[model samples]
Target: MNNFKPYYAVIFTSTQATDIKGYLVMAEKMENLAKQQKGYLGMDSARNEVGITISYWESLEAIKNWKANTAHLFAQQKGREQWYNWYNVRICKVEREYEFTLE
Candidate 1:
């Protein structure tokens, strides 16, 4: 992963029906598309009764680019129309962060 003094984290929380309906395809597309974005850092997602995805980017501009992406826009519309019962998006600047890993 790239290191930076400052960056952004986009947290997406969603409650979805078990019905799902094309969600897997769309979700995969979103992840792959996000990586292709200019300021993308990385992302992780998990699904249970609810789903959460935390994506990182270099700047607000990069985040905006991902949000405004045509395919992503379509998915958003579809989410509103059929996929998600409810969802929330929050963006925060990371002032500091640390992690530890053992291998």
Candidate 2:
């Protein structure tokens, strides 16, 4: 979670195709590349029948830059051609957030 207020979240929901050939490697690569990008805050992801990845950013412009990144573009093309059977991406401004911890 990010401490800063008014951050942006890119919520990526995906369902993997049966043939996941290079999915894991590409996913890891993208995550590492995203971490090296400007305005990148953090990311949390989970996978089961459906996969959900939420990545936090400092601004919408940063998100745009990430979307336009060459490597990411190639990954996106591959996702359309192979990896993902279905996917949806949503970008939102996070104004307020709260969480609880159990010990």
Candidate 3:
């Protein structure tokens, strides 16, 4: 499935702390929870020296709801307290998208 309509994208960029023991588990949990949310459309993630995760949403309200979710709030706290050294979140309207694939 794909979204061709106008939507919202939450871009999360971060650098990890040296001690991130439970971070991966919590991240996976959050991903699953996000999939179950009201306006969740899709997500893409990659990590190298810097981690970037873009979560697609149907609307700004949906994004706000996710940010306010209990479990997500806990994750956010954990991220600040233990997992991330620095992070930035940007919410933008995605008005257009295009891709090329080689199969």
Global lDDT of each candidate: 0.91, 0.97, 0.97
Candidate 3, residues 66-101, lDDT tens digits: the string is 999999999999999999999999999999989899
For residues 1-103, write the lDDT of model 1, one tens digit per residue: 7564888999999999657789999999899989999999999899888899999999999998898999999999999988889899999998888899998
Tens-digit lDDT string for candidate 2 (53-92): 9999999999999999999999999999999999999999
> Cα miss at 91, model 2 (Å)?
0.5
Which ten contiguous residues of candidate 2 have the minimum total lDDT?
Answer: 1-10
* TM-score, prediction 3: 0.95
Q: 1 or 3: which has the higher lDDT?
A: 3
TM-score of each: 0.91, 0.94, 0.95
Clashes of each: 0, 0, 0
Q: What is the lDDT of residue 32 in candidate 1?
A: 93
Candidate 2: what lDDT?
0.97
User: Which numbered prediction scores highest in TM-score against the true structure?
Assistant: 3
